[model samples]
Target: MATGTQPPASGTDPRRAGHGVRGATRAAIAPRHLRTDRWWLAPAGTAAGLLAFVVYSTWRAFSNSDYYAAPYVSPFYSPCLAENCVPMRHGPNWELFGGWWGLSPALLILVFPLGFRLTCYYYRKAYYRGFWASPPACAVAEPHTSYTGETRFPLVLQNLHRYFFYAAVLVGVVLTYDTVLTFRDEQYAWGHMGVGTLLFLVNIGLIWAYTLSCHSCRHIIGGRLRHFSKHPVRYRLWGWVGRLNQRHMQLAWASLISVAACDFYVYLLATGAFADPRLF
Candidate 1:
């Protein structure tokens, strides 16, 4: 009855004092919110879209079929270096392992672009919100009790994004070469253009845009520079990359769609599902 400590004021919380609500008891609530605003739609759509692409691409990669048509190779199977790669279908046929391994040709090359996208800054944010529901949306609360962030294990590998960017650039170069080769006919003679050629060209352009607009590329171009006057060329390059970075999200999605579309187009041509119209 004569306790020295005073009770909290009628309308205020004692636990909310300097340390906001650290040890406060949580309300026994059901769902976080009851308002009907279609909040779950975004993540749902993202999950569905990404899942469809993953399934289709994985199937195509493992099927190892119809990845190439004369003068056009699917972006999924470019730089075909496997011995199992059909000489007529996948081309290149670098025979890197000399027919020893009976693996899918896509196994040899999809990793670079896959790694690039997996570690992409925008993709990381997209999937984190889309798939993991790590605080899924703007006002949503995460299901976890603690936050560990990206400082450990699998997430830590995100640091390798810069290296993956390098690999992606080389892959882009290979794809560009494939695009150039598309100018030739089945006999390797130049001056041919088809519906497939434009598709490959557009796909490569989108990929280059996406890759160049990457956050890692932006940093490499301008991160540590002290004085812009000292390096006007680098500064100018950085400015260009900065502009692209501003649209990185759009480019990322555009490239994803285009790459898949390009591969599917080649698949159709290879399977004779569709005839490539000559644009020449």
Candidate 2:
């Protein structure tokens, strides 16, 4: 007999047998649970929340009786696309052109969320996380890995962010300017809007909060620069930024909710939901 016969099958030699069994089991059932363990859950949930807020809010906005597509016809739609867009006032709201969406207060606020959702770093995070729900904003499932392929329409909509950046900034300025007009209501004039100055202030606050918490901006502002820590102010700001970042998912969710809720109040005031919003 060979003296080296398989190392005599020592009592402590269970390792090989155990590993073989585990390897065989893994090989047999590995791919089945891949779908459930998908890595895209985080982003998916955040996006679902955003879309729910938008769609519900949009429906409410267009369905209100405070706006329409024509002038002085019960509730009226302010002519929006002309060189002479009227400041919104009392009007009936409804759809027109068969299924075309008519204008209203909801539409006004939608600009901010829609724009922010696209341009936001947090939203990008959500999108990257695979948001494992159904398709949100036109998506149905998270990709197993990176989405390197090219498609049109829905994919192309991502480009809308650049244009929406302009829109969001313009809207922010307009809303701020409207704030100025609201405080000095003693000097009101045509095409001037001063409603919800405080609410608009809230919107601005939310924007700054979201902007400062951004990953790109954070990195731009000493996040990536180690030497900047020598400066007390930079260090302090970075410290707070870090705090926000620690609860980043929280901040992202809260900021979106805050902006949307603030917008909703303004729209409600605009559509006469409340006699006058509690501006305090």
Candidate 3:
């Protein structure tokens, strides 16, 4: 021992002997964080943007009447499983939930895509900083006294992100089908196209980009492979996914905004706000 120096405590780093470890002790700093510049702006902006989307999506989900127009259906209400769906032909016609179910058909199907977003790894970072303020930004101290991470209850459900990825893929497929259906006119003629069709095309494209770029999708395509040389096909696909994954955050926001805009366009048409101008 060096000249009456105290011994290092258990489960701590020697280099950080004077500094604090999370869940052990607070650092000797006086401020909440030592950031000098405008560090709070990013988290504040994230919180505002996320809150706006939640409010808009929640309102649209409940007000389901305007979500469906001929040859166009909102992404939020696709695979319309209920019999009561407006213009039921837009749906699969299976009516899995039966006519007895009276709630918005959007509610029935939104869970899958919603679950996918809620459990998304990127979104976890987003909301944890934006909504929860759990260490809102880099080097910032969280107000929470303790952190359990995603180990308990609702947060633990994040492990189901992989499963939700499958559901999101299915939803993407359904949205593609819906977009294809938009090629037809109200008379059901196959040769017609409209401005809404273009919007649908753009929205679905963004949706697929976001969905395929998911961390879970990347893992499913690339994980568990010990030898890249042994599987050239998977390796190529993994590389492609890796490129997309780099833009995951941008794709996430773009797709979210596009889906909402697409649905809003459908709502405008359904409400007789204007006629969908034909491109043909």
Q: lDDT of each prediction vs. the true structure?
A: 0.85, 0.48, 0.88
Root-mean-square deviation of each candidate, in angstroms? 3.7, 8.8, 4.9
Task: Summing lDDT over every window of 10 consecutive residues in candidate 2, give the lowest-scoring window.
Answer: 69-78
Q: With candidate 3 superimposed using the best TM-score fit, by how many Å does residue 228's alpha carbon deviate from the native?
A: 0.9
On the 0 to 100 scale, the lDDT of residue 245 in model 1 is: 95
Q: Comparing 1 and 2 by TM-score, which wins?
A: 1
Which is better, 1 or 2, measured by lDDT? 1
lDDT of 1 by residue, 1-280 (tens): 4554666668765546434556766554688765468888888888888888899889998888888788788888878877777776334446676554566888788988999899998888888988999868777887878888999898999989999999999999999988888997777778998878888888899999999999999899989999989999999999999999999999998999999999889888889897889878
Best by lDDT: 3
Using all chains and alpha carbons, the TM-scores for the candidates as numbered come to: 0.88, 0.52, 0.88
RMSD of 2: 8.8
Candidate 3 residue-wise lDDT, 1-280, digit = tens: 6854977779866666766455545446678777899988988898898899899989998886888788788888888888787764664574788765478888889999989998998889999998889878998889999999989998898999999999899888888999999999887779999999999999999999999999999999989999999999999999999999999999999998999999899999989999999999
Q: Is candidate 2 or candidate 3 better by lDDT?
A: 3
Flag the better candidate by TM-score, 1 or 3.
3
lDDT of 2 by residue, 1-280 (tens): 7764545356634444345464443334434234544344445565577678767656655664433211111111221232222343322222222222434544444555466566565566465443433233333344345554324665556655545555555555544443444443322333433335555456566655655565554564575665764777877787777666666666666656655555455446556555442222
